[model samples]
Target: MDKIRRWVQEGGTLITLKNASEWAIKQGIVKEKLLIPANGGWADTTATRAASTAPASEGKKTKETASASTPGSRRTDFVNQEHEGTRAIAGSIYRTDVDLTNPIAFGLTDRRLYVFRNGTTFLRPSRNPYATVAQYTATPLVSGYVSKANLKQISNSAAIVVSKVGAGRVVLFADDPNFRHYWHGTARLFTNALLLGPLLNLPEGPATISAEEE
Candidate 1:
């Protein structure tokens, strides 16, 4: 982890997704942790079952009690990221809300994208200043069946975050844009990241320290 951190600090670009992003945060390569919190939404069975069958007395349980203690009952939060496991939101179509003016959004005439077996990811970056070039128009549904009604959108969450790390750059993708061979529409977005990430002159943030500084 330390070696990787040094590499990133020395102007090496890092493009990470899902578990890799989560691991980077934990290792201090990135400062913020992103997690899909345990809730009734998506494929969280514990949250669903608890909400459906638990009595009023169980509702009054302490935070410690509600805390993730079992495999099925574990919270999907970043702290329990490895616990709840990744979900595949099969056959879901997402609209990409893009900053068309941004260079990273080049060649994108349409905002629609498709996903197959897409995982559930909720990102909240607290330690770095990043520009959101694109985001899902709606909260991503993480199950075999995609349903718009299952999502509860929050204004601050994003699907992509681009930031400068030292002299290089880092791009964090909450979910896989290219899910399978059939979801070829999102390949352009991924290509944009590859071509534009290093070119991005991101605003200064805690993670933007110069390579010569330390």
Candidate 2:
């Protein structure tokens, strides 16, 4: 913790696991750890794969190399980003009841995903590519090449709604059923995902879930 404290004090805001490891040396978190780049180890793999259950065009396959690296990005022990944005890292009540039924489901591998973001009040970043605030939750679904599986079914077809939200071209896939469940605490873990629907929704397919946008 001390090494981490020094890194934070030294203007190290954004970081990855490797970066954290390096910072540990200065702050004594790890006692002389070296700074090494994280290959594809931290990038979100679930976001780009077709998986066995959900397949799609929009959710195309973006191949990930175990050692490949991208620019302006870092690897965290958390979501394991491919780049700067949250492609699909998730949080939730438990591991099994994850939120994969939603497109964000892939991150948890068809499980109950959750969000570690701020909450309903704040807005998204100024130059945000997505429509939601920086606080919403998600699990990476799919990306890359010719994928047509996006037209497939989510976990619970009837219990949720996958469509665009707001006018800014954001496609938010939300659920109305969890409103009561999240509050109950004992309610299903995924119930929070449904309750969070209205708040964390993002843009769905304007372009083909298969075609790449320039």
Candidate 3:
């Protein structure tokens, strides 16, 4: 992880997915948490599930911190939120917003992009200038069997998160675009990240942007 941090400080881009997203966010690279169902069927632990539905607290605190333990001596701060998960939501078609202007979003056409199994995390307010390159607009349903009650509690979250860590770029995905070598709609996104990720613009300033995962 330290080596990875060094690469990023040297202007390298780290593209992470699924459980990897959980790791990066926890390390402060992405500023969010990748959540998964505590059990195979349920979305998350009871506490996280409930907190996921509660409205964003107006009084939530935002703080900043600086650390030079790493290579570039990056300083960052952002509000973090506890998030829940939907049953993987595989095989279901969902539309997410795409920022065409962002280089990381290059090659994607149409105002929206169709994807399968967007199990990524969401962001809360933060000082990091991260951007939501793509986000879910509607409640997501489990691919085969999910309760309406569960879906109703789902929050429209970022399907794709882009930010600069030190001199490098990081792209966080809810789930792997290449889940099983069958889902192809979002493969371009992964490709774009590999090709254009390093060139991704750094956040101009602090902006609103997730949680600890087991």
Best by lDDT: 3
Write down the worst ten-residue block by lDDT for model 2: 117-126
Off by over 4 Å in 1: 38-88, 111-117, 125-130, 138-144, 147-150, 153-156, 205-214
* Candidate 1 least-lDDT 10 residues: 41-50
For model 2, residues 97-185, the per-residue Cα lDDT tens digits are 33344433323333333322111111111122232211122222232221122111111111122223132112222222134344332
Candidate 2 lDDT for residue 34: 22
Could you tell me how far off, in angstroms, the CA of residue 1 lies in candidate 1 after the best superposition? 1.3
To one decimal, what is the Cα RMSD in angstroms of model 2 from the true structure? 20.9
Winner of 1 and 3 under lDDT: 3
lDDT of 3: 0.60
Q: What are the per-residue Cα lDDT tens digits for candidate 1 across 117-209? A: 355565553334446666656454433554333244322355667766677667777667666655666666677878776676776645543
RMSD to truth, every model: 11.6, 20.9, 13.6
Each model's C-alpha lDDT? 0.57, 0.27, 0.60
Give me the candidate number with maximum TM-score.
3
In model 3, how large is the Cα lDDT of residue 89? 41
- Give the Cα error of residue 184 in candidate 3, in Å: 2.0
